[model samples]
Target: MTDRTPPAPSLAQLRALIAVADAGGFGEAAAEYGVSQSSLSEAVAKLEALAGRPLLRRTPGGTVPTEAGARVLTHARAAVQAAADALLAAQEENGGLSGTLRVASMRSAATHLLPPALAAFRARHPRVTVALLDSDAGGGGAPAVRSGRADLAVILADEAPDLRLSPLPPDEYLFVAPAARGTHPVTLAELGAAPLILPPHLDSCYRRIRTYLAARGVSLTAVSEVEQDSVILSMVGHGLGVTVMPRLALLPLPPGLVALPLPEPLARPLALAALPHRAGLPVIRAFTQAVLSHLPVPELPAKEPGPLPVPVSAPPLN
Candidate 1:
């Protein structure tokens, strides 16, 4: 009797599966990938046949990966990324860099820090495309890199383990109050005098501030908890209450508010995060160099170890 074994699935099939999962439907995935819906459907069908299991299920909302498909999807992303890295390595000497580099970043970093770095990168490698994924919540970027959805992420230092980190400049947390209410170098007692306008309880920044203040034997009453930085700033402008926010988040401070350094300064530690295995890839290295070159680094006091902030899961890819 002859032995019969199915051949391994092709790269095309794996990519098709990934696209479908990402887009949440065959038609949308095909449109985004610039391929015919029938072709994508065919590729996924063949992939499922080889695995001898259903990979996707259709619902009223859209298509989603099955239990088995979710397991396979993880490996599929890794396999695709490995192949892309190999190709990038081979082409490094032949011509300019070309490919998409996905980066996940917090809102403030994206708004204030990434523009110049991205400009520098584009100047050198115009052929490369940069895709930004929003990861506003603290520690959110780490999961994007782990899932292979983003090649690099700007995340809080020590946010996740088992990944490579390249430190960026620390952003100082300042005491923001109505200009009429304070002077520079506000004391802890003065900070606690007014109701504090803070980010929501679940925000990583909020947790960091709370931890730092608790260590100093201080606790302030909160007047309101808000999610949007702009809204928080607006409220402060109207003298609703004072807030403590990272300097990066207070950029272009409105006219009516004053951001004073606290008597004992607090800063948010930040770093670039990438998968340990993929950190050295040529494209990632180039972007990392661009960022490091463009962002200014200042002398900062050594960071003291503190309680770890809770890790928030990245939202599912759409």
Candidate 2:
């Protein structure tokens, strides 16, 4: 048997190493963990030395785990999770759900859904801090939830997930343009003729919009593609072209634009997702409750099922 000193690896070292690997770079990992790169690097180096083998390899784009590094990372993540579970369990035993509640959401949700709920939630749980982020489009919210950086995510739901997800409330898609343009609703076939501003191909809204139109044998003529709601709304306000956006986005509409409900009645269901292990936490439960209490659901069509316990709120308009 070989005699080797079993190094005591600190949680900090494991976290630094994991963050760098997940973030794909030292700078990003350091920023995420609120540590200087040098400090993070030192911690990672110490971890590698303790492990008795090199665990990571520096690449042009970022750092990647070598074969040995991947093993270390897997175990490190497990250990970190165990430690977190222990801490959360201890907190539960000693106190109530009182800690920072990190939330990641899309911009439209941030603008319309979060404010009132957050305000009410704050009044109820004054000790629990809230951190909300409008993460990148294309559902980058997944990373925030998976990384433990966010306790909960209110986002466009992916059909299949590696995490537990619960549907919040449904939001509708609308073909919005300047109100001065017209009152009559335009069909997808007719609107396919006009130049359009649209979401990027990878965006859930864009993909769903495409699928709906495609199913009806229609397609919008694209003038340009943009990633955020604000840009699309601004372009519509300027009469650059019409764009399809969630009705919730109407809350932040520029002066000249108006949103008309789509005839198709296609509703995108939003969801709250967290690691399955974290689903039972009070913070997650409270956050989910806060979400259910805030989403401004639209009127359901006669044939459709009644809206979920959608909070009574005004139309998705300013």
Which candidate's TM-score is highest? 1
TM-score of each: 0.86, 0.79
Task: Give a tens-digit lDDT track for model 1, residues 205-233.
Answer: 88988888888877676557898989998
Q: How would you encode candidate 2's per-residue C-alpha lDDT over 1-318 as one tens digit per residue?
A: 897867699999998889888888789888887889999889999998988888888888678988998888777887887687665655551255676777888777776677777877777777878988767643467777776667787766765378788886677777777768765666776568767788888777888887877888876666588977788888787878888777676665566666665667787888878888887776677777776777665555444322112245533321
RMSD of each: 6.8, 5.1
How many pairs of residues collide in each model? 0, 0
Worst 10 residues of 2 by lDDT: 302-311
lDDT of 2 at 274: 85
lDDT of 2 at 147: 62
Provide the overall lDDT of each model, using Cα atoms, as 2-decimal numbers. Answer: 0.82, 0.74
Give candidate 1 misplaced runs (Cα > 4 Å): 1-6, 93-95, 137-139, 297-318
